[model samples]
Target: MNLVKRLKICVFTFALLFIGTAVNAQITNDITHEEAFTALLAAKKNAEDSNVLVNIAVVDAGANLKAFIRMDESYLGSIDVAIKKAKTARYFNMDTGKLGELTQPGGIIYNIELTNNGMVSFPGGLPIKNKDGKIIGAIGVSGGTIEQDRAIATVGAKSILE
Candidate 1:
């Protein structure tokens, strides 16, 4: 083959190889239920450090509740809100703030926030991802201020891989 033709063929082959690798690299591993509960308990302990009465909820990627806990004196009113927020995080694979954005007026995905059974459109929820970088679950915290809730959820989500 001529030099230019050979160079073109090599580049095309390299491009095809790159595309194949990219597609395979997208595979992911999911977190287990045990990891989800462990993360929740650890989060609870973290929140306890601040003397915050918090309710924590964990949900799987499919937005199904996996585990839940509320401090003995936590507000009952926050339980459902906490669970829903957790599920929302898992389903959307992001933090609760993004979920809020999705539900904001004029947001393209606004109506989706209303589809889940008990999703909360507020912060304090975070998606849980495994080593493979696939989000497999989420954590939510409530019974405190929104900031405190977000802090607790952050701790919980971080604990999953620790």
Candidate 2:
């Protein structure tokens, strides 16, 4: 490459890196262990009250697993689903149900779940938000019917709000 071209490329790369770092630094990861635990407990309780067995997963702002619980008699196959659902919620910063709607055939971004290392786009995933409406984490539940799972996850997500 010419000297001028190489210099321009280097400058462009540097600017991009600097901007990414600055933007990432501004995003606060306030999802502590306590918050994750609270979400898990709340979700578990909801499942119990509903007489549903379920697996629950919680993820921090970085989309890393923070907490998980598998209730007695929950389907073993649902463990991975729960974790992936939580990750899917955090990865897109939206409820997985919404993702499901968008990924449906004829909808925008159809088959998106094929990407992102295999996401679960169905219901049972929710973003945990603070009172200010900023998402701090996410929760996912599985093993129950779609409605039951979504309800349980919502209870979990709401418990730690703010």
Best by lDDT: 2
Q: lDDT by residue for model 1 over 18-114, one digit each (tens)?
A: 9999898642455577898888988999888999998999887767788899899999999988998888787778888877887788988776766
Output the worst ten-in-a-row residue range by lDDT, candidate 2. Answer: 23-32
- Candidate 1 weakest ten by summed lDDT: 24-33
Superposition error at 62 for model 2 (Å): 0.6
**TM-score of every prediction relative to native:** 0.76, 0.82
Clashing pairs counted in every model: 0, 0
Candidate 1: C-alpha lDDT: 0.85
Best by TM-score: 2
| lDDT for position 27 in model 2 | 50
Error of 2 at 135 (Å): 0.7
Note the Cα lDDT for every prediction shown: 0.85, 0.92
